[model samples]
Target: MCGVGGIFFKSAEHGAKTGEIAYRILDGIYRRGPDSTGVALWHDNADGLLYVGVNCEAPGGGGRILEALDQLGTVKQATDGDGYIRAAIAYGGSEEDLVDAIDALDPAITVSSVGRHLEVLKHMGGVANLDAKFDLKSYDGRLAMGLTRYATESRIDFTNGQPLSARAVPGLAVMHNGHITNYHHLRSSYALKGYNFSTQNDSEVIPIMLIDEMSKGATFEDALNITVDKLDGCFTYIAVTDDCFAVVKDAYAAKPTVVAENDEFVALSSDPQSLREGVLSDIEVWEPGAGEVHVWQM
Candidate 1:
């Protein structure tokens, strides 16, 4: 089992406290999957452009990928953690251009998500490791989502981590719980479409499929429905973007998902303990319906 959780906030309304709120929400679920933890936050500047990035793994190969990116543009900030690395690039270019540059820099370097207000990153390790390594507390953003993973398929190292992102689809990142039995078949299908696979974990297949559907002009809701229909297994998945956030449970509903929200904010997690510890001390919490797809927009 894995622990997944996220929060969607009206950045304009919450203003500066958004990052703190997001962090607390993520911190709540640290016990669910202590193997690794990561977060994605979204926010807009006065210019109205979105800023997004994630904290995740740096393929089997090391700093060569990051060094190449630094050569192309300026590497704003970079930090090394146990089995992971977190970095930021200050590029005055399009997200697509930056993503292309990152990919070109190293085939292993992938953009987890991009949006007017979101960025995400994740990799194998404890929350403390990610925090000390990345200095996450100082990060500033609007809305954010994070995950702590205990791998079921791939190795329990940096390669198999959560907050898997869909770079091809701007502003999309996913965290999943449970297994996708038909993952091999799905992986082959996407491979034929030119989407490469990295980690052997089934969760990696999610972003590729989501990006493919989005490329075909599917809305987040549409993509969610299609994903539930296509993937064969028991799962509870969460996806976040600059403008929206969604949670979908498989048809069989074998996995658990609880949602808590009020006028100020909305939070979701695999269990209530995290919500209680990380978010609000006293809040109403309810389990989502079976085959349910919950969406929140900022």
Candidate 2:
């Protein structure tokens, strides 16, 4: 099993670093998944230009990705760890524009995440070790989602980690905690429509499925409704956008999930026990019924 969790600051008054908050929740459930941890944070730089983080095994190997960045616009800023690198892309084009350009650089270059406000970073380590590489504490934003992998569906590299971004739609990230039984059918269908699959993991399709529906002008909720009907699985997944946070549980409850909300924030984790760690202990906790959708709109 994998640990999927996220936290959204509902009130602008709360200026806490959302990535750190997401890390805390994800760390709480670290026992559930210790293979690798990934996080997505939403933040709009003062320039109004979009920032996207592209990651590969090492910063040295990312020279090709860097060259593609030059063609986009300007590389405003960049950073890296042992094997992961992030660049602030200032392209007037859609978020997918940056992603596609990076994908064109090399097959190994994974567009970790792209958004006007969100950046995705993940690596091959646990909650305790991963944070030492990148500074999640400074990742201030409105929404963040993350996952710790148990390596159920794919290899344990950083590229195969959770919080997979949807290539067709930027600013959309998905974290899944269980297997999808009908993933091959769905994957084949999306591939036919020009949606590329970059990972072997079944959960990556969740965000792709959502973004596909979203491209048709479907609301976030409507897209999820279609996802529930189209995919067959026992899973609890969470999705994040610049404007809203959504959590959906499969009818079979194949995976566990718990939610706690207050005026300031909405917190979700794999289980109630993890939700209590460094979170709002005073608030009430409950499980969304199977097939239930609990959404908090910003």
Candidate 3:
């Protein structure tokens, strides 16, 4: 089974602590998906213009990415992380425009995440090798989610990894466990509606379908509820947006999930063991009922 886990702070906390905790949570669920790891985080820079996390394949977070984005707008802040470059670009443009421009400059550059408050980092490796490519402990944000991908229906590659953000809207992120039996049917429908897809993984559609509903003016919760009814599968998904964190299960309640929360933090995992490994021993934990929905605002 694939592993999906998330930790959301009720308020913005110290970046280092937040990052460190994210790592711990991933460690708890490491066994669930040892093939690839993905983490998505949200933080605001207090600017009206959206600040994107540029995860380009530039050698040394170099001038190539800067040159490409320079055509769009100024680079306000940039950093060379474990194995990716993170940058904030100032541009009053759509996310598609920014990503397409970067691809034009360097086809190797993958915009892993784009949003005013979101950053996604992932690579083709396991928990044993994750630290070499990413330092999620250094990532800071009000909320975060990580997934360990155990490839089933899709090929094993970095591009197919989970914690996938929507193509049209990058701020929303989804981490799912279990298979989507009707993935092809749903993907076909989205294709007919002109929604482009990047991977064959069943989990990828969760964010795309969820985004489609939100684009139509549905609140995140309402969109999630609608998605549950539309998708036919025994799956569970954890969603994190700029404003809130949520967990929703399929109607059958086939997948496993546990939640633990106190005044300071809220943690979710595919199993109770993960919750124990990720959070303090004193926190109360319980299982969510079938088709249940739980959400906490950041």
Residue-by-residue lDDT tens digits, candidate 3, 113-220: 677777676765654355555556666666767888888988776557777776647668788888888999989998899887756678878898888898899988
Model 2 residue 291 distance off true place after TM-score fit, in angstroms: 0.4
Q: Weakest 10 consecutive residues, lDDT, candidate 3? A: 53-62
Q: Give me candidate 2's TM-score against the actual structure.
A: 0.92
**Model 1: number of backbone collisions:** 14
After superposing candidate 2 on the true structure, give the runs of residues whose Cα lies further than 4 Å from its correct spot: 280-282
| Model 2 per-residue lDDT tens digits across residues 1-298 | 8888877787666867776666678788888888988877777567866656666754476666667776787888766655567777667876666777777666667777777776777877776566777777666667777888888778877678878877646677888888898999889999999888777889989998888898899989999878877889788888877777788888876788888888888888886766776474755777888788778887
In candidate 1, what are the lDDT values of residues 1-298, reduced to their tens digit?
7778766655455644544555566666666777877776665644544343432344444466557557656666565443455556555667667666665655445555555555555655655566566655665554667788877788776556777775445667788998999999999988898886656779888878877897799987898889999999989999876677889999998998888887767877787877665565678899988788988887
Point to the candidate with the largest lDDT.
2
In model 3, the Cα lDDT at residue 105 comes to 62
Whose lDDT is higher: candidate 1's or candidate 3's? 3
* RMSD (Å) per prediction: 3.2, 2.0, 2.8
Report clash pairs, candidate 3: 19-137
Model 2 / residue 185 / CA error / Å? 1.2
